[model samples]
Target: MIARWTSTILAAACLLAAPVLAADLRPGTAGEGNFRVNVAASGGPSELPDRIGPVSRIKDIATLLTARDNQLIGYGLVIGLQGSGDGLRNSPFTEQSIRAMLQNLGIAMEGGQARAKNVAAVIVTANLPPFVQSGARIDVSVSSLGDASSLQGGTLVMTPLRAPDGEIYAVAQGPVFVSGFSVQGQAETLTKGVPTSGRIPSGAIVERQVDARFNDDTVLTMQLRNPDFSTTIRVTDTINAYTQSRFGKRTAAEQDSRTILINRPTEVSAARFVAELENLLVETDTPARVVVDERTGTIVIGQDVKISQVAVSHGQLTVRITEQPQIVQPAPFSDGVTAEEPSTTIDAQQAGGQVAMLEGPDLQTLVSGLNRIGVKPDGIIAILQGIKSAGALQAELVLQ
Candidate 1:
């Protein structure tokens, strides 16, 4: 058919094009092609376009140096565990907390021992975000500190959350909501997720305000989450270009690969300048990198990765050995006894093996070379490592 003849001609052209492409690859020069490295899954490669990636807003890539979160922690008690709570005798702290709470409420606990099984000691934690004012409700996490089985259906008593300076900044008290459960029988026990950990939404209300004023400073520093020389240069250029257009002068200075200092205009407040600065768009750059996790057989390739022309031959050889036991009977009249015999067999096979010429100037050709070999993920990995060893891979190979 015409279609078959066309396919044959195309294959022949591809085979004949290798030497011409390889000749163009001079000494110590990368091949010519545009590529972006992103494979969605094993054996099912996602298509990479010829162009670079999209630009992103500055806010998505960088953060202000002064804006941060503070941690708050406190010790507390949980009530109503339905007999799955800690035993007061084993956890003396739980008994002590109960007695102190009773004393605070003007109810005296006599000298007798409290044998309550429904109370457990716990640690409560929450994050105080930057600029969070008083009366703002934040979420809190509760974790058991005693030998309690579960925290399901328990109510946390009023606990004061303190900062590192030992000052109470918030008060947390709420009904715990657990995502898992546990059940025990006479013979066996089964548990889903850890029932001792739970979280409360809007469980803590701030009482003290952190003295933070964002607009007070005339200048601010912006820090990048991932420090890179190329990305830092690009960000600085973008900011300067924007400032020149608006004020006829540049106000941003690049301190290093990670930090940048910007002077807010005297007419504009710090908040307004930061709002405009963070919305500027910049094209990011990344080094060519190939990361492989051998345990999970995962490979992540960067956009700028390239390969050189190389010849590769890969195949899978499988050998199987099986054993069988046989019984032997004695002859009709002789004084011989029955005996057992051992039998063994082996099978060896090689399938889907091929010798292919890989011409790499771009990710498409590289993947096309792999497809010609009919290889799987493991074979792909081995071939990549082999190419790296031969100096045919243009990117850095990292094994993790």
Candidate 2:
């Protein structure tokens, strides 16, 4: 009887062990974490713009005759920060904004002593592009108004963005997308980029559309971004040539250096006229000028920039002084007191330089001449300024 009972017990144990063994043998039944495989897709070649003698479409070179983007501004609050927001106690405007927002939502708050360190008062700005219909999205920029440490991880509440005419144009409400972050600990703090400002892509919705006057006007104008008499003449000639070839009539005229007046033909509609003319290619004409950014030490020489015969020399003199203190001790037998003696070393040196003549029949020679001088950007800026002052640089020197 004992042996039979033992055999039955062993069989029952074996039946339970069989299922456990089978499950362990099956795939995806391991206790390890799941594995993921990522495949990268290949991309095709890219198209780059031709910088030299570049031909651009008429539409790319100039803005539409009357269509322009209007600026919209608003005030709002940004919440949800990691203690990097404005101090509510110090910023009464934030408390006021909060109170007004709460009242607008049918919530009544009696006291204005709300203390929230994770909320910041911000100024939101967005540009309403031309011909943007209702319910369209636009980007907005948010900037802190008070002493806020960071604007990361914040959500902008519903705020009405108004134009200069006091008309509400769009409504902005979205999570702030900050490319930077700020972190603080007991030992140190770390920050990158600008933490007090952020941008929200597609954050504003247009509620009203500004009426486009060009739609009903018989004549449309084209305003060049970089106005030049030569460019204006070229644009007008191109348009007139296209019209003469297609409609057998000249419909374009140059009004000024910046504006080209387009006379709409009776048969061709304004939409069709503009569509055809905007795609017409015209070689851009730029003035002979040198654009210099003083802050960044950047120099941009235009294609037509020319320099007369001029001599330029670059040299710098540096003087350095260092102080060293020495402790003087008296001998054991001599009656002298220990005292500190001061010694200073002065160094003066000047870098050697030779004057180089610049005679630019073209742009390449001018660049080579400047490079041959082996001067730093700051030195080059000074030399260029001196050349411009002496009337050696034929191009207009614009300082920025």
Candidate 3:
């Protein structure tokens, strides 16, 4: 009984506090209800500064323009799968690969005939990143190239991973690690994720090194992940300022929106210069955008977004249907058929249909005005679209 009384008091307090909060709102504000817009703009909401983000390291924004990962691919076979493996008759490649393996082991087989329900042909692939030395272990992904139901609980045979130049750079062979599984029964089937694909973590041993010329070039290039003219200029200016303070001259210049060339100073080692330059921070810029996810009813507003005076009114239409079935009985001693007749009554109601005038000189006021009308997410989407069509909403609307 005490808990019940406590809950009652809490509800009463909420009811009493609601009107007091609403009383603080502007005169034109509508009644508040279940809807709200919670946006954490990059700049403080009240300030609404022009800048969208703080300083970030050059290494976080750009990649070393010269260095990149190399793609490697190989063909091999997976074995030891419990009847889920490929059918030897259907997958000729599986038989061919098995026969080749046996022949290499000094067992000469004629016609390349090999029969095994536990073996499956697969493609092995891995990305050999720059600076990876010989004997380094890397992860390899194995994918079924046959009619195998699942690669779960299977062991991958020896496979040679080769770069595009047709040179074997790594050797991959290990027990496959399948994160998902599949089960098939006569009556039902259940599966999760993809069963025909799996990965072997750190299963490939690199046998060759791809040489990178970081020191050979007198100038090093930096490539931005996202190309922006303002960001490129800022990066150039920031690097120049830092270098001028240390070396008495500007060493970096913007080559384009995506590239920056840095002259290697003679006093510093190439690696040391790059390592130090990558850590310098520069403020980043972002375009004003409002992202809305229709499926999840999520809306994100940027800090620099603005709006002209606009009006929004959202009303909900409720539809109700009731069905009643009545039966007619035959009279005693009278031959008559009894039948059921369905009577349906539909009632529709339009409530809170009045338009609420919403006008704001700033983003905060605009959000508050929209929220005060108690509009649901879908209704808000329609209203926002209408506002944008009327040239009131200034930010770009992106639908996801």
Q: For model 2, where is the 10-residue window of minimal lDDT?
A: 9-18
Query: TM-score of every model?
Result: 0.73, 0.81, 0.73
lDDT of 2 at 309: 95
Comparing 2 with 3 on TM-score, the higher-scoring candidate is 2
Report how far off residue 154 is in candidate 2 (Å).
1.4
Model 1 gets an lDDT of 0.75
Compose the digit string of candidate 3's lDDT tens values, residues 1-400.
3233222111111011112231221121111222222112211212223455768999999877556677777777888999898988788767777776776655778864666788888888898877788889999999998999999989987777766555567878899999889998999999998999999999998887776555555567777997876787788777777888888867776767797767767798768888888999987766667788899998887766777776666778999999998998888888888988889999999876667787766568877987888878887787878888998888899988
RMSD of 1: 20.9
Expressed as tens digits, the lDDT of each residue in 1-400 for candidate 1 is: 3233222111111011112332221121111122212111111211332336669899999988756776778788899889978888788888887877776666778986788888888888888887888999999999998899999999988777767655567878899999999999999999999899999999999887777656665567788887866677677767877877887766666667787666666688777888999999877767788888888888787767788878888878999999998999999999999999999999999875667888767667766777788887778889899999999899999999
lDDT (10s digit) by residue, model 2, range 1-400? 3233222211111011112222221122111223211111111111233335769899999866456677788778888887888887778787777776676566778964677888898888998887788989999999999898999899988777767655567778889988877888999999898889999999998887876544354566678999987777778778877888898866666667897666666687667778989999988878889989989999999877889998887888899999999999999999999999999999998884688898787899989999899988878898899999999999999999
| Model 2 score (lDDT) | 0.75
